[model samples]
Target: MTRPPLAVIAGTGFYDLEALEDRVEESIDTRWGPARVTRGSWHGLPVVFLTRHGPGHSVPPHLVNYRANIRALADLGCEDVLAVNVTGSIDPGLVPGDLLCLDDFLDLTRQRPLTFFDGSGPEGVVHVDVTTPYHPALRRELLEAAVAAGHPLRDGGVYAAFEGPRFETAAEIRLARLAGGDVAGMTGVPEVVLAREAGLRYAAVALVVNPCTGVGDSEEPITMEDIEAVLATSREAVLAVLDELVHTRATFTEEGTG
Candidate 1:
C-alpha cells in the first residue's frame, strides 16, 4: 500500500533533511510559479521537503515564493506540513538555541504574495478562518515529540513575522516587544497563513538563533555569522526533535491507516 505524503518546510541553516536516505527531486508547477521539491523517506514514512529559502539559501525572506511553495506541496497531496523556522529571541527566557513550538503569529510583512486567493486564479477569493493559524493536532504532535525526544522546548510562543532580508532595528524590536511578540523572524508570515488557506495542517517549530536586536548578550551588531554559530550548535537538538516528530507522525498514520 502507498503512504501519504508528509511535507516538511525547512528554514534557514536547515536546507536539507539529512535523515532522508532515499530521495528524489520533483519539480512542481503552480499558478503562482514553480517549486523544486525533494521527496524521500523518513523512518519508513514518505516525506517531502522544500527549502523555504531555496537550496543554496539564495532566495531572500521577502522574495520567497510563499504561494507557489504551499501550492506545490498541496498539489502533490501533502495533507500536513511541518514548518521549521529560524527565529530571533524577543523574550528574555527564550535564549539562543531554544526551541519554540509557535502557537500564534503577528504578521508585520509589508508586501508579498500573502495569499492564493487572487481573483485572477481559478479559485476566486475564498476566505479561510485565520483565528487559529496553526493546526491543533499537528501542534500537539510536535510538542509531544519534543518532550519524548528529551529536547528542551517551550510549548507555546508568539512569533512575530517581519518582512525582511534585513534584520529588525532595535527600535522595531522594542515596538514588537510592546506589541507582545516573543520571537521574531522573517519567513513565518504568508507561509503559515497560506497553508491554512490551502487546507493543509501546518505547524512551525522555531529555533531561536539570536537575541532580537535589543536583547540578550549582544554588544555588537548582529550578523549572519552570529546566527550561523548559534544554529550550528542547536542543529543537533533540532534534528532530534525532527526525528521524533517523524516517528510520531508515522505512529499516527499507522493508527489511521489501520
Candidate 2:
C-alpha cells in the first residue's frame, strides 16, 4: 500500500491550503493533546494539512503542542512534512516579499522541550543528528519548485527561532543576524528538532513578511494584522511551490512503479 506523499504544517496566518479537494477535517489525539488535521488531495496528490495554531489561531508560540502535531502525522503513516512559516527578515535585502528555504536553525526558544527523548518516551535519549537540520533533498525540491514558479526564493538560510508572542527588540535582532540568522520567527525550533527525531523528512519554506526590528526603521510598530496581510502578496508563490513539490513527488512515485 502506498502512503500519502506529504503533510503540511501551516504556521501563523496560513490556516489551510484552500486548493485542497476531497477534504475532510479530522480530529487526532496523541500523547500531547488533540489536534485538528485536514486530510485531502491537493493537485491530485494525497496530502494532509495541519494548522500549528488551531482552528481559531488562539495558541501562542510558547504554548503550541509541537509533539502532538508531529506525532499525529507520523502515526497516520505520513513520512514527510512541509512546514510553511511566516518570518521576519534579518538580512538587508530579504524584504517582506521574499521566500527562504531554511537549511539551518538557531533555536533561541526558552522552556520548550528540545527533544522527544525525555528518558521516558524512548529508551535512554536518542540523540538524532541535526548536522543538516533541514532535509537537503526536500529543500532542493522546494527551491526548484519556487524558481520554476517564477518566485524569488533564497536557496538557503539559517532560521532563528524565538519564543515569542512578541516581536524581538532591535538589539535582539542585531544579535540574531550576527549569529547567522537570516530569518526570525516563533515556532521553527522544536518542530524541526522533533521532526528529525521522528525520522520524517522535513523542510521549511519561510515567507518573509516584514523586516526584523532593527534591520529597517526600528521604531515603527507593526500590527499582527499587518504582518498577516503580507502573506497575501506571496500567496500565489506559496501555493505554487507547494503544488510543485507535491506533484514532483507524485511524478517520481509514478515513474518508480512503472
lDDT of each structure? 0.89, 0.86
Candidate 1 lDDT tens digits, 1-258: 666788999888988888886999888999789998999999889899999888789999999999999999999999999988999988987888899998999989999888878788777888889887988889898888889999977888899999998999988888889999999999999999999998999999999988888897667888999989998899889889889988876787788889
Clashing pairs in 1: none
Whole-model lDDT, model 2: 0.86
Per-residue accuracy of model 2 over 137-156 as CA lDDT, tens digit each: 88888999887777878889
Error of 2 at 85 (Å): 1.0
What TM-score should be assigned to candidate 1?
Answer: 0.95
TM-score of candidate 2 relative to the true fold: 0.95
